[model samples]
Target: MILTSVLPELILLSADFGLIGSPRWRPLAYQYGAFWAGLLHGWQPNFAVQPVTMFLTHAFLHTGPMHLIGNMLALGVLGQMILERHNTGQFILIYIAAALGGGTTYGLLSHSAVPMVGASGAIFGLAGAQLVWRWQDQPKGDLSHLRRLAELCGGMLGLVVINLLMWWLQDGQLAWQTHLGGTLMGVAAAGLLPAQRPILLKIRS
Candidate 1:
Protein backbone atom coordinates (compact mmCIF):
# COMPACT_ATOMS: atom_id res chain seq x y z
CA MET A 1 0.00 0.00 0.00
CA ILE A 2 2.73 2.47 0.96
CA LEU A 3 4.83 1.55 -2.04
CA THR A 4 1.91 2.24 -4.38
CA SER A 5 1.02 5.49 -2.62
CA VAL A 6 4.52 6.89 -2.14
CA LEU A 7 6.62 5.34 -4.91
CA PRO A 8 5.72 7.96 -7.50
CA GLU A 9 6.88 10.88 -5.41
CA LEU A 10 9.87 8.86 -4.32
CA ILE A 11 10.88 8.54 -7.97
CA LEU A 12 10.33 12.20 -8.78
CA LEU A 13 12.07 13.34 -5.65
CA SER A 14 14.95 10.92 -6.34
CA ALA A 15 15.99 12.76 -9.48
CA ASP A 16 16.17 16.17 -7.87
CA PHE A 17 19.71 16.30 -6.49
CA GLY A 18 18.51 18.47 -3.68
CA LEU A 19 15.52 16.38 -2.61
CA ILE A 20 16.22 14.71 0.72
CA GLY A 21 14.13 11.57 0.50
CA SER A 22 15.44 10.61 -2.90
CA PRO A 23 14.22 7.11 -3.62
CA ARG A 24 16.39 7.12 -6.72
CA TRP A 25 19.35 7.36 -4.38
CA ARG A 26 18.32 4.59 -1.98
CA PRO A 27 21.16 4.96 0.55
CA LEU A 28 20.77 8.71 0.91
CA ALA A 29 16.99 8.52 0.83
CA TYR A 30 17.09 6.50 4.03
CA GLN A 31 18.28 9.57 5.90
CA TYR A 32 16.02 12.35 4.63
CA GLY A 33 12.27 12.86 4.75
CA ALA A 34 9.88 13.35 1.83
CA PHE A 35 9.55 16.91 3.10
CA TRP A 36 13.26 17.28 2.69
CA ALA A 37 13.12 16.09 -0.91
CA GLY A 38 12.63 19.66 -2.08
CA LEU A 39 15.04 20.92 0.53
CA LEU A 40 17.60 18.22 -0.12
CA HIS A 41 20.13 20.70 -1.43
CA GLY A 42 18.51 24.05 -0.73
CA TRP A 43 18.69 26.38 2.25
CA GLN A 44 15.69 26.10 4.58
CA PRO A 45 13.65 28.38 6.91
CA ASN A 46 12.71 29.88 3.57
CA PHE A 47 9.05 28.99 3.08
CA ALA A 48 9.09 30.56 -0.37
CA VAL A 49 11.56 27.90 -1.51
CA GLN A 50 9.14 24.88 -1.38
CA PRO A 51 7.28 24.36 1.88
CA VAL A 52 3.79 24.12 0.42
CA THR A 53 4.54 21.18 -1.84
CA MET A 54 6.36 19.39 0.93
CA PHE A 55 3.31 19.81 3.13
CA LEU A 56 1.36 17.35 1.03
CA THR A 57 4.14 14.95 0.04
CA HIS A 58 6.00 14.54 3.33
CA ALA A 59 3.36 12.30 4.86
CA PHE A 60 3.65 9.76 2.06
CA LEU A 61 7.37 9.05 2.45
CA HIS A 62 8.42 6.61 5.15
CA THR A 63 11.79 5.79 6.67
CA GLY A 64 11.62 2.00 6.74
CA PRO A 65 9.47 -1.13 6.78
CA MET A 66 8.95 -0.98 10.53
CA HIS A 67 7.83 2.62 10.29
CA LEU A 68 5.37 1.82 7.54
CA ILE A 69 3.97 -1.21 9.31
CA GLY A 70 3.30 0.58 12.61
CA ASN A 71 1.76 3.61 10.95
CA MET A 72 -0.42 1.57 8.59
CA LEU A 73 -1.70 -0.61 11.40
CA ALA A 74 -2.71 2.33 13.54
CA LEU A 75 -4.27 4.12 10.59
CA GLY A 76 -6.32 1.08 9.60
CA VAL A 77 -7.70 0.58 13.06
CA LEU A 78 -8.49 4.18 13.97
CA GLY A 79 -9.53 5.17 10.47
CA GLN A 80 -12.33 2.62 10.63
CA MET A 81 -13.45 4.02 13.97
CA ILE A 82 -13.43 7.58 12.63
CA LEU A 83 -15.35 6.54 9.53
CA GLU A 84 -18.02 5.05 11.71
CA ARG A 85 -18.57 8.44 13.30
CA HIS A 86 -17.78 10.91 10.50
CA ASN A 87 -17.81 11.57 6.78
CA THR A 88 -14.96 11.25 4.30
CA GLY A 89 -14.36 14.98 4.12
CA GLN A 90 -13.80 15.26 7.83
CA PHE A 91 -11.49 12.25 7.80
CA ILE A 92 -9.42 13.83 5.03
CA LEU A 93 -9.18 17.07 6.93
CA ILE A 94 -8.07 15.32 10.08
CA TYR A 95 -5.41 13.41 8.20
CA ILE A 96 -4.09 16.57 6.54
CA ALA A 97 -4.00 18.39 9.82
CA ALA A 98 -2.10 15.50 11.40
CA ALA A 99 0.44 15.40 8.57
CA LEU A 100 1.02 19.13 8.77
CA GLY A 101 1.32 19.12 12.52
CA GLY A 102 3.79 16.25 12.47
CA GLY A 103 5.88 17.73 9.70
CA THR A 104 5.99 21.15 11.27
CA THR A 105 6.99 19.74 14.61
CA TYR A 106 9.78 17.64 13.08
CA GLY A 107 11.04 20.55 10.97
CA LEU A 108 11.17 22.86 13.93
CA LEU A 109 12.72 20.49 16.45
CA SER A 110 15.19 18.21 14.69
CA HIS A 111 18.81 19.26 15.19
CA SER A 112 20.43 16.19 13.64
CA ALA A 113 19.85 17.40 10.08
CA VAL A 114 18.15 14.08 9.33
CA PRO A 115 15.21 14.28 6.92
CA MET A 116 11.97 12.99 8.40
CA VAL A 117 9.68 10.50 6.63
CA GLY A 118 6.49 8.43 7.02
CA ALA A 119 2.69 8.79 7.48
CA SER A 120 3.10 8.11 11.17
CA GLY A 121 1.99 11.56 12.24
CA ALA A 122 -1.31 11.21 10.42
CA ILE A 123 -1.83 7.70 11.76
CA PHE A 124 -1.19 8.89 15.27
CA GLY A 125 -3.94 11.43 14.78
CA LEU A 126 -6.46 8.70 14.04
CA ALA A 127 -5.45 6.90 17.21
CA GLY A 128 -5.99 10.12 19.13
CA ALA A 129 -9.50 10.41 17.71
CA GLN A 130 -10.38 6.99 19.07
CA LEU A 131 -9.00 8.00 22.47
CA VAL A 132 -11.19 11.08 22.53
CA TRP A 133 -14.29 8.98 22.02
CA ARG A 134 -13.33 6.67 24.85
CA TRP A 135 -12.62 9.49 27.25
CA GLN A 136 -15.98 11.12 26.57
CA ASP A 137 -17.86 8.02 27.64
CA GLN A 138 -16.99 5.07 29.81
CA PRO A 139 -18.23 1.52 29.22
CA LYS A 140 -21.81 1.94 27.98
CA GLY A 141 -22.79 -0.59 25.33
CA ASP A 142 -22.58 -4.36 25.62
CA LEU A 143 -20.15 -5.30 28.36
CA SER A 144 -18.04 -6.87 25.66
CA HIS A 145 -18.15 -3.78 23.47
CA LEU A 146 -17.29 -1.58 26.40
CA ARG A 147 -14.55 -3.96 27.48
CA ARG A 148 -12.87 -4.07 24.09
CA LEU A 149 -13.04 -0.30 23.78
CA ALA A 150 -11.54 0.05 27.22
CA GLU A 151 -8.80 -2.39 26.39
CA LEU A 152 -7.95 -0.60 23.18
CA CYS A 153 -7.87 2.77 24.88
CA GLY A 154 -5.79 1.53 27.77
CA GLY A 155 -3.27 -0.14 25.49
CA MET A 156 -2.86 2.97 23.36
CA LEU A 157 -2.53 5.24 26.34
CA GLY A 158 0.04 2.92 27.83
CA LEU A 159 2.04 2.78 24.63
CA VAL A 160 2.14 6.56 24.35
CA VAL A 161 3.13 7.04 27.93
CA ILE A 162 5.77 4.37 27.82
CA ASN A 163 7.22 5.60 24.56
CA LEU A 164 7.41 9.12 25.87
CA LEU A 165 9.09 7.96 29.02
CA MET A 166 11.59 5.95 27.07
CA TRP A 167 12.39 8.96 24.96
CA TRP A 168 12.88 11.04 28.06
CA LEU A 169 15.16 8.48 29.60
CA GLN A 170 17.30 7.79 26.56
CA ASP A 171 16.85 10.97 24.53
CA GLY A 172 16.60 8.55 21.63
CA GLN A 173 15.94 9.20 17.95
CA LEU A 174 12.24 8.54 18.20
CA ALA A 175 9.98 11.23 16.79
CA TRP A 176 8.52 12.26 20.10
CA GLN A 177 7.35 15.65 18.92
CA THR A 178 5.72 14.24 15.82
CA HIS A 179 3.85 11.61 17.79
CA LEU A 180 2.59 14.18 20.26
CA GLY A 181 1.43 16.50 17.52
CA GLY A 182 -0.36 13.78 15.55
CA THR A 183 -2.02 12.25 18.57
CA LEU A 184 -3.26 15.59 19.88
CA MET A 185 -4.60 16.61 16.47
CA GLY A 186 -6.31 13.25 16.11
CA VAL A 187 -7.99 13.61 19.48
CA ALA A 188 -9.20 17.08 18.61
CA ALA A 189 -10.49 15.80 15.28
CA ALA A 190 -12.83 13.47 17.10
CA GLY A 191 -14.75 16.50 18.30
CA LEU A 192 -14.87 17.94 14.80
CA LEU A 193 -16.26 14.66 13.45
CA PRO A 194 -19.97 14.00 13.75
CA ALA A 195 -21.03 11.56 16.44
CA GLN A 196 -23.91 9.16 17.07
CA ARG A 197 -24.22 7.50 20.41
CA PRO A 198 -24.48 3.76 20.02
CA ILE A 199 -27.60 2.33 21.58
CA LEU A 200 -26.84 0.82 24.92
CA LEU A 201 -29.22 -0.99 27.21
CA LYS A 202 -28.08 -1.60 30.75
CA ILE A 203 -28.01 -5.36 30.98
CA ARG A 204 -26.08 -5.46 34.22
CA SER A 205 -24.22 -3.19 36.63
Candidate 2:
Protein backbone atom coordinates (compact mmCIF):
# COMPACT_ATOMS: atom_id res chain seq x y z
CA MET A 1 0.00 0.00 0.00
CA ILE A 2 2.70 2.43 1.00
CA LEU A 3 4.64 1.38 -2.07
CA THR A 4 2.18 3.26 -4.28
CA SER A 5 2.78 6.49 -2.38
CA VAL A 6 6.53 6.08 -2.22
CA LEU A 7 7.14 5.13 -5.85
CA PRO A 8 6.68 8.67 -7.16
CA GLU A 9 8.97 10.16 -4.54
CA LEU A 10 11.48 7.33 -4.80
CA ILE A 11 11.88 7.88 -8.52
CA LEU A 12 11.94 11.68 -8.45
CA LEU A 13 13.37 12.73 -5.10
CA SER A 14 15.43 9.70 -4.22
CA ALA A 15 13.89 10.05 -0.78
CA ASP A 16 14.21 7.46 1.96
CA PHE A 17 11.01 5.44 2.59
CA GLY A 18 11.44 5.30 6.38
CA LEU A 19 9.20 8.17 7.55
CA ILE A 20 5.94 7.39 5.73
CA GLY A 21 3.57 5.40 7.98
CA SER A 22 0.16 3.75 8.22
CA PRO A 23 -1.97 3.86 11.39
CA ARG A 24 -4.20 0.83 11.70
CA TRP A 25 -5.58 -0.97 14.78
CA ARG A 26 -4.35 -4.36 15.92
CA PRO A 27 -5.73 -7.23 18.03
CA LEU A 28 -3.23 -6.74 20.85
CA ALA A 29 -3.75 -3.04 21.54
CA TYR A 30 -5.92 -3.47 24.65
CA GLN A 31 -3.61 -6.14 25.92
CA TYR A 32 -0.64 -3.84 25.52
CA GLY A 33 -1.72 -0.21 25.83
CA ALA A 34 1.77 0.78 26.87
CA PHE A 35 3.17 -0.29 23.54
CA TRP A 36 0.27 0.98 21.44
CA ALA A 37 -0.20 4.40 23.08
CA GLY A 38 2.17 5.96 20.58
CA LEU A 39 0.21 4.39 17.77
CA LEU A 40 -2.97 6.08 18.97
CA HIS A 41 -1.10 9.37 19.08
CA GLY A 42 -0.11 8.96 15.43
CA TRP A 43 -3.44 7.63 14.15
CA GLN A 44 -5.66 10.47 15.28
CA PRO A 45 -4.24 13.96 15.21
CA ASN A 46 -5.19 17.61 14.73
CA PHE A 47 -6.27 18.10 11.11
CA ALA A 48 -6.02 21.89 11.22
CA VAL A 49 -2.35 21.52 11.93
CA GLN A 50 -1.82 18.61 9.54
CA PRO A 51 -4.36 18.62 6.71
CA VAL A 52 -1.88 17.58 4.03
CA THR A 53 -0.52 14.88 6.35
CA MET A 54 -3.78 13.04 6.86
CA PHE A 55 -5.35 13.62 3.42
CA LEU A 56 -3.07 11.02 1.84
CA THR A 57 -2.03 8.95 4.85
CA HIS A 58 -5.51 8.06 6.05
CA ALA A 59 -6.43 5.93 2.98
CA PHE A 60 -3.86 3.35 3.90
CA LEU A 61 -5.49 2.50 7.26
CA HIS A 62 -8.36 0.07 7.85
CA THR A 63 -10.16 -0.84 11.07
CA GLY A 64 -9.49 -4.59 11.29
CA PRO A 65 -9.79 -7.91 9.46
CA MET A 66 -13.47 -7.36 8.74
CA HIS A 67 -12.92 -3.89 7.31
CA LEU A 68 -9.88 -4.93 5.31
CA ILE A 69 -11.61 -8.03 3.98
CA GLY A 70 -14.67 -6.13 2.82
CA ASN A 71 -12.56 -3.50 1.04
CA MET A 72 -10.21 -6.04 -0.59
CA LEU A 73 -13.17 -8.04 -1.88
CA ALA A 74 -14.57 -5.00 -3.70
CA LEU A 75 -11.14 -4.06 -5.03
CA GLY A 76 -10.47 -7.59 -6.27
CA VAL A 77 -13.74 -7.95 -8.17
CA LEU A 78 -13.44 -4.55 -9.83
CA GLY A 79 -9.67 -4.30 -10.18
CA GLN A 80 -9.28 -7.64 -11.99
CA MET A 81 -11.02 -6.37 -15.10
CA ILE A 82 -8.89 -3.25 -15.30
CA LEU A 83 -5.67 -5.18 -14.68
CA GLU A 84 -6.37 -7.75 -17.38
CA ARG A 85 -6.80 -5.07 -20.03
CA HIS A 86 -4.07 -2.62 -19.02
CA ASN A 87 -0.34 -3.24 -18.68
CA THR A 88 1.61 -2.84 -15.43
CA GLY A 89 2.42 0.81 -16.12
CA GLN A 90 -1.17 1.69 -16.96
CA PHE A 91 -2.45 -0.20 -13.93
CA ILE A 92 -0.16 1.64 -11.52
CA LEU A 93 -1.02 5.01 -12.99
CA ILE A 94 -4.76 4.36 -12.99
CA TYR A 95 -4.78 2.86 -9.48
CA ILE A 96 -2.90 5.73 -7.85
CA ALA A 97 -4.88 8.33 -9.78
CA ALA A 98 -8.10 6.68 -8.63
CA ALA A 99 -6.81 6.40 -5.08
CA LEU A 100 -6.04 10.08 -4.86
CA GLY A 101 -9.14 10.91 -6.85
CA GLY A 102 -11.44 9.12 -4.41
CA GLY A 103 -9.56 10.11 -1.24
CA THR A 104 -9.33 13.77 -2.18
CA THR A 105 -12.95 13.86 -3.33
CA TYR A 106 -14.05 12.47 0.05
CA GLY A 107 -11.91 14.94 1.95
CA LEU A 108 -13.33 17.87 0.02
CA LEU A 109 -16.95 16.80 0.60
CA SER A 110 -16.65 15.76 4.22
CA HIS A 111 -18.55 17.73 6.85
CA SER A 112 -17.39 15.53 9.73
CA ALA A 113 -14.64 16.27 12.23
CA VAL A 114 -13.10 12.79 11.97
CA PRO A 115 -10.63 11.96 9.16
CA MET A 116 -11.38 9.69 6.17
CA VAL A 117 -9.71 6.43 5.00
CA GLY A 118 -9.91 3.35 2.69
CA ALA A 119 -9.41 2.39 -1.00
CA SER A 120 -13.03 1.69 -2.04
CA GLY A 121 -12.89 4.85 -4.09
CA ALA A 122 -9.94 3.51 -6.06
CA ILE A 123 -11.77 0.26 -6.67
CA PHE A 124 -14.74 2.25 -7.85
CA GLY A 125 -12.40 3.95 -10.31
CA LEU A 126 -11.65 0.60 -11.90
CA ALA A 127 -15.38 -0.12 -12.04
CA GLY A 128 -15.98 3.20 -13.77
CA ALA A 129 -13.31 2.45 -16.34
CA GLN A 130 -14.68 -1.04 -16.98
CA LEU A 131 -18.22 0.27 -17.50
CA VAL A 132 -16.86 2.81 -19.96
CA TRP A 133 -14.83 0.26 -21.92
CA ARG A 134 -17.78 -2.10 -22.11
CA TRP A 135 -20.05 0.60 -23.43
CA GLN A 136 -17.57 1.75 -26.06
CA ASP A 137 -16.68 -1.72 -27.35
CA GLN A 138 -19.75 -3.91 -27.01
CA PRO A 139 -22.65 -2.32 -28.84
CA LYS A 140 -25.08 -5.21 -28.33
CA GLY A 141 -25.75 -8.68 -26.86
CA ASP A 142 -26.72 -7.86 -23.25
CA LEU A 143 -29.04 -5.09 -22.34
CA SER A 144 -29.71 -7.28 -19.32
CA HIS A 145 -26.12 -6.70 -18.20
CA LEU A 146 -26.75 -2.97 -18.40
CA ARG A 147 -29.89 -3.22 -16.28
CA ARG A 148 -28.14 -5.49 -13.82
CA LEU A 149 -25.34 -2.94 -13.58
CA ALA A 150 -27.88 -0.23 -12.90
CA GLU A 151 -29.43 -2.45 -10.22
CA LEU A 152 -25.99 -3.00 -8.80
CA CYS A 153 -25.58 0.76 -8.47
CA GLY A 154 -28.95 0.94 -6.79
CA GLY A 155 -27.96 -1.85 -4.42
CA MET A 156 -24.75 0.00 -3.60
CA LEU A 157 -26.81 3.11 -2.97
CA GLY A 158 -28.86 1.10 -0.50
CA LEU A 159 -25.65 -0.03 1.18
CA VAL A 160 -24.56 3.59 1.38
CA VAL A 161 -27.81 4.42 3.13
CA ILE A 162 -27.21 1.58 5.57
CA ASN A 163 -23.62 2.73 6.11
CA LEU A 164 -24.82 6.24 6.94
CA LEU A 165 -27.53 4.99 9.29
CA MET A 166 -25.04 2.85 11.15
CA TRP A 167 -22.61 5.72 11.10
CA TRP A 168 -25.20 7.93 12.76
CA LEU A 169 -25.57 5.24 15.39
CA GLN A 170 -21.81 5.35 15.97
CA ASP A 171 -21.90 9.16 16.38
CA GLY A 172 -20.29 9.83 12.96
CA GLN A 173 -16.87 8.23 13.13
CA LEU A 174 -17.59 6.72 9.72
CA ALA A 175 -16.83 8.45 6.42
CA TRP A 176 -19.41 7.52 3.80
CA GLN A 177 -18.46 10.71 2.04
CA THR A 178 -15.42 8.93 0.66
CA HIS A 179 -17.58 6.15 -0.68
CA LEU A 180 -19.87 8.66 -2.37
CA GLY A 181 -16.97 10.52 -3.92
CA GLY A 182 -15.35 7.31 -5.14
CA THR A 183 -18.57 5.99 -6.66
CA LEU A 184 -19.27 9.19 -8.57
CA MET A 185 -15.70 9.45 -9.77
CA GLY A 186 -15.86 5.85 -10.84
CA VAL A 187 -18.96 6.54 -12.89
CA ALA A 188 -17.51 9.69 -14.38
CA ALA A 189 -14.29 7.95 -15.34
CA ALA A 190 -16.12 5.59 -17.68
CA GLY A 191 -16.31 8.42 -20.17
CA LEU A 192 -12.62 9.15 -19.80
CA LEU A 193 -10.82 5.79 -20.52
CA PRO A 194 -9.86 5.50 -24.20
CA ALA A 195 -11.75 2.84 -26.19
CA GLN A 196 -9.61 -0.15 -27.17
CA ARG A 197 -10.74 -2.73 -29.74
CA PRO A 198 -9.69 -6.28 -28.97
CA ILE A 199 -10.05 -8.81 -31.87
CA LEU A 200 -12.22 -11.36 -30.08
CA LEU A 201 -14.53 -8.76 -28.52
CA LYS A 202 -14.92 -7.13 -31.98
CA ILE A 203 -16.36 -10.30 -33.52
CA ARG A 204 -20.13 -10.50 -34.10
CA SER A 205 -22.15 -11.37 -31.02
Candidate 3:
Protein backbone atom coordinates (compact mmCIF):
# COMPACT_ATOMS: atom_id res chain seq x y z
CA MET A 1 0.00 0.00 0.00
CA ILE A 2 2.79 2.41 0.91
CA LEU A 3 4.63 1.65 -2.34
CA THR A 4 1.56 2.60 -4.36
CA SER A 5 1.67 6.11 -2.94
CA VAL A 6 5.11 6.72 -4.46
CA LEU A 7 4.41 4.74 -7.61
CA PRO A 8 4.60 7.86 -9.72
CA GLU A 9 8.15 8.63 -8.68
CA LEU A 10 9.18 5.05 -9.16
CA ILE A 11 7.73 5.01 -12.64
CA LEU A 12 9.52 8.27 -13.37
CA LEU A 13 12.83 6.83 -12.21
CA SER A 14 12.33 3.92 -14.58
CA ALA A 15 11.59 6.23 -17.49
CA ASP A 16 14.60 8.43 -16.74
CA PHE A 17 16.89 5.43 -16.56
CA GLY A 18 15.62 4.11 -19.87
CA LEU A 19 16.16 7.46 -21.57
CA ILE A 20 19.77 7.57 -20.54
CA GLY A 21 22.41 7.02 -23.29
CA SER A 22 19.75 7.16 -25.96
CA PRO A 23 20.11 10.26 -28.09
CA ARG A 24 16.67 9.72 -29.64
CA TRP A 25 14.81 9.60 -26.31
CA ARG A 26 15.79 13.13 -25.36
CA PRO A 27 13.90 14.61 -28.29
CA LEU A 28 11.03 12.20 -27.68
CA ALA A 29 10.44 13.49 -24.18
CA TYR A 30 10.00 17.04 -25.37
CA GLN A 31 7.90 15.95 -28.28
CA TYR A 32 5.44 14.19 -25.99
CA GLY A 33 5.25 17.10 -23.52
CA ALA A 34 7.20 18.56 -20.62
CA PHE A 35 6.24 21.55 -18.49
CA TRP A 36 7.70 24.91 -19.42
CA ALA A 37 6.84 28.57 -18.96
CA GLY A 38 5.37 28.81 -22.43
CA LEU A 39 2.64 26.28 -21.69
CA LEU A 40 0.68 28.87 -19.79
CA HIS A 41 1.87 31.79 -21.92
CA GLY A 42 0.38 30.16 -25.05
CA TRP A 43 3.76 29.84 -26.71
CA GLN A 44 4.13 26.08 -26.36
CA PRO A 45 4.66 24.24 -29.63
CA ASN A 46 1.92 22.22 -31.29
CA PHE A 47 3.35 18.90 -30.09
CA ALA A 48 2.79 19.59 -26.41
CA VAL A 49 -0.38 18.32 -24.74
CA GLN A 50 -2.90 20.53 -22.96
CA PRO A 51 -1.24 22.79 -20.39
CA VAL A 52 -3.61 21.67 -17.64
CA THR A 53 -2.55 18.03 -17.91
CA MET A 54 1.12 18.95 -17.96
CA PHE A 55 0.81 20.44 -14.51
CA LEU A 56 0.41 16.95 -13.05
CA THR A 57 2.37 15.01 -15.68
CA HIS A 58 5.46 17.15 -15.17
CA ALA A 59 5.84 15.74 -11.66
CA PHE A 60 6.74 12.38 -13.19
CA LEU A 61 9.73 13.64 -15.14
CA HIS A 62 13.31 14.18 -13.87
CA THR A 63 16.53 15.71 -15.15
CA GLY A 64 18.97 12.97 -14.20
CA PRO A 65 19.88 10.10 -11.86
CA MET A 66 20.90 12.20 -8.87
CA HIS A 67 17.83 14.36 -9.28
CA LEU A 68 15.56 11.33 -9.21
CA ILE A 69 17.47 9.77 -6.29
CA GLY A 70 17.17 12.75 -3.96
CA ASN A 71 13.46 13.22 -4.65
CA MET A 72 12.69 9.51 -4.32
CA LEU A 73 14.49 9.34 -1.00
CA ALA A 74 12.53 12.26 0.40
CA LEU A 75 9.29 10.85 -0.94
CA GLY A 76 9.85 7.40 0.50
CA VAL A 77 10.79 8.60 3.97
CA LEU A 78 8.26 11.39 4.38
CA GLY A 79 5.53 9.55 2.48
CA GLN A 80 5.74 6.53 4.76
CA MET A 81 5.54 8.71 7.84
CA ILE A 82 2.51 10.59 6.50
CA LEU A 83 0.73 7.39 5.48
CA GLU A 84 1.09 6.06 8.98
CA ARG A 85 -0.86 9.01 10.40
CA HIS A 86 -3.29 9.88 7.58
CA ASN A 87 -5.27 7.74 5.15
CA THR A 88 -3.96 7.05 1.66
CA GLY A 89 -6.64 9.27 0.17
CA GLN A 90 -5.53 12.30 2.16
CA PHE A 91 -1.90 11.66 1.29
CA ILE A 92 -2.75 11.46 -2.41
CA LEU A 93 -4.77 14.65 -2.20
CA ILE A 94 -1.86 16.56 -0.69
CA TYR A 95 0.56 15.19 -3.26
CA ILE A 96 -1.53 16.17 -6.29
CA ALA A 97 -2.42 19.57 -4.87
CA ALA A 98 1.21 20.27 -4.08
CA ALA A 99 2.33 19.36 -7.59
CA LEU A 100 -0.26 21.60 -9.20
CA GLY A 101 0.53 24.41 -6.78
CA GLY A 102 4.20 24.15 -7.63
CA GLY A 103 3.58 24.07 -11.36
CA THR A 104 1.26 27.03 -11.20
CA THR A 105 3.81 29.08 -9.28
CA TYR A 106 6.57 28.17 -11.72
CA GLY A 107 4.41 28.95 -14.74
CA LEU A 108 3.56 32.35 -13.38
CA LEU A 109 7.02 33.41 -12.21
CA SER A 110 9.78 31.79 -14.25
CA HIS A 111 11.14 33.39 -17.44
CA SER A 112 13.38 30.52 -18.43
CA ALA A 113 12.45 28.56 -21.56
CA VAL A 114 13.82 25.32 -20.21
CA PRO A 115 11.30 22.85 -18.79
CA MET A 116 11.22 22.64 -14.99
CA VAL A 117 11.21 19.04 -13.84
CA GLY A 118 11.48 16.93 -10.64
CA ALA A 119 9.46 15.97 -7.56
CA SER A 120 11.03 18.39 -5.12
CA GLY A 121 7.88 20.47 -4.91
CA ALA A 122 5.69 17.49 -4.04
CA ILE A 123 8.26 16.22 -1.55
CA PHE A 124 8.39 19.58 0.17
CA GLY A 125 4.60 19.47 0.34
CA LEU A 126 4.84 16.20 2.27
CA ALA A 127 7.29 17.84 4.62
CA GLY A 128 4.99 20.79 5.19
CA ALA A 129 1.93 18.59 5.77
CA GLN A 130 3.92 16.50 8.21
CA LEU A 131 4.88 19.57 10.20
CA VAL A 132 1.36 21.01 10.25
CA TRP A 133 -0.18 17.65 11.18
CA ARG A 134 2.14 17.31 14.16
CA TRP A 135 1.29 20.83 15.24
CA GLN A 136 -2.45 20.25 14.90
CA ASP A 137 -2.31 16.99 16.83
CA GLN A 138 -0.94 18.65 19.95
CA PRO A 139 -3.27 18.82 22.94
CA LYS A 140 -5.08 22.10 23.53
CA GLY A 141 -4.51 24.66 26.34
CA ASP A 142 -1.18 23.35 27.48
CA LEU A 143 2.49 24.34 27.49
CA SER A 144 3.11 21.04 25.77
CA HIS A 145 1.40 22.34 22.66
CA LEU A 146 3.84 25.24 22.53
CA ARG A 147 6.79 22.94 22.94
CA ARG A 148 5.57 20.53 20.26
CA LEU A 149 4.85 23.41 17.90
CA ALA A 150 8.34 24.74 18.45
CA GLU A 151 9.80 21.34 17.79
CA LEU A 152 7.84 21.12 14.54
CA CYS A 153 9.00 24.57 13.48
CA GLY A 154 12.58 23.70 14.38
CA GLY A 155 12.48 20.63 12.18
CA MET A 156 11.05 22.64 9.27
CA LEU A 157 13.71 25.27 9.85
CA GLY A 158 16.39 22.67 9.34
CA LEU A 159 14.84 21.72 6.01
CA VAL A 160 14.71 25.38 4.93
CA VAL A 161 18.39 25.85 5.81
CA ILE A 162 19.28 22.72 3.89
CA ASN A 163 17.32 23.96 0.87
CA LEU A 164 19.11 27.32 1.03
CA LEU A 165 22.47 25.59 1.26
CA MET A 166 21.61 23.45 -1.74
CA TRP A 167 20.58 26.55 -3.67
CA TRP A 168 23.98 28.08 -3.06
CA LEU A 169 25.83 24.85 -3.80
CA GLN A 170 23.93 24.17 -6.98
CA ASP A 171 24.38 27.78 -8.17
CA GLY A 172 20.62 28.29 -8.03
CA GLN A 173 19.58 25.23 -10.01
CA LEU A 174 16.76 24.46 -7.56
CA ALA A 175 13.22 25.69 -8.21
CA TRP A 176 12.47 27.32 -4.88
CA GLN A 177 9.29 28.87 -6.16
CA THR A 178 7.79 25.41 -6.58
CA HIS A 179 8.89 24.46 -3.08
CA LEU A 180 7.18 27.53 -1.61
CA GLY A 181 3.96 26.96 -3.50
CA GLY A 182 3.72 23.27 -2.63
CA THR A 183 4.39 23.94 1.04
CA LEU A 184 1.69 26.57 1.30
CA MET A 185 -0.88 24.31 -0.29
CA GLY A 186 0.12 21.26 1.75
CA VAL A 187 -0.03 23.05 5.11
CA ALA A 188 -3.35 24.64 4.23
CA ALA A 189 -4.92 21.39 2.99
CA ALA A 190 -3.80 19.42 6.03
CA GLY A 191 -5.16 22.01 8.41
CA LEU A 192 -8.53 22.10 6.65
CA LEU A 193 -9.25 18.46 7.45
CA PRO A 194 -11.53 17.90 10.47
CA ALA A 195 -9.59 17.03 13.61
CA GLN A 196 -9.97 13.47 14.86
CA ARG A 197 -13.21 12.95 12.97
CA PRO A 198 -12.24 10.08 10.67
CA ILE A 199 -11.70 6.39 11.15
CA LEU A 200 -8.46 6.71 9.15
CA LEU A 201 -6.82 8.75 11.88
CA LYS A 202 -3.91 6.71 13.26
CA ILE A 203 -2.69 8.72 16.21
CA ARG A 204 0.32 7.12 17.86
CA SER A 205 -0.13 6.63 21.58
Question: What's model 1's overall lDDT?
Answer: 0.65
- Worst lDDT run of 10 residues, candidate 1, spans 29-38
RMSD of each: 6.4, 9.3, 4.5
Point to the candidate with the largest TM-score.
3
- Residue 154 in model 2: lDDT: 63
Lowest summed lDDT window (length 10), candidate 2:
28-37
Candidate 3, 19-46: lDDT as tens digits: 4345456445554545777767767555
Q: Tens-digit lDDT track for model 1 on 88-183? A: 787788888887877776666655455566687887777777667765554544457667667667867775896677578747867777777777
Off by over 4 Å in 1: 1-33, 36-49, 139-159, 165-171, 196-205
Best by lDDT: 3
> Which parts of model 3 are misplaced by more than 4 Å?
1-22, 47-49, 144-156, 196-205
Q: What's the lDDT for candidate 3?
A: 0.73
* lDDT agreement with native, every candidate: 0.65, 0.52, 0.73
Candidate 1 global TM-score:
0.65
Kindly state the number of residue pairs that clash in model 1: 7
Estimate, for each residue in 25-144, the C-alpha lDDT of model 2 and write its tens digit. 222221222111123344443334344444444455554445556667776676667666666566555566666676666656654434345565666566656655655554356446
lDDT of 3 at 205: 52
lDDT of 2 at 49: 36
The candidates, ranked best first by TM-score, are 3, 1, 2
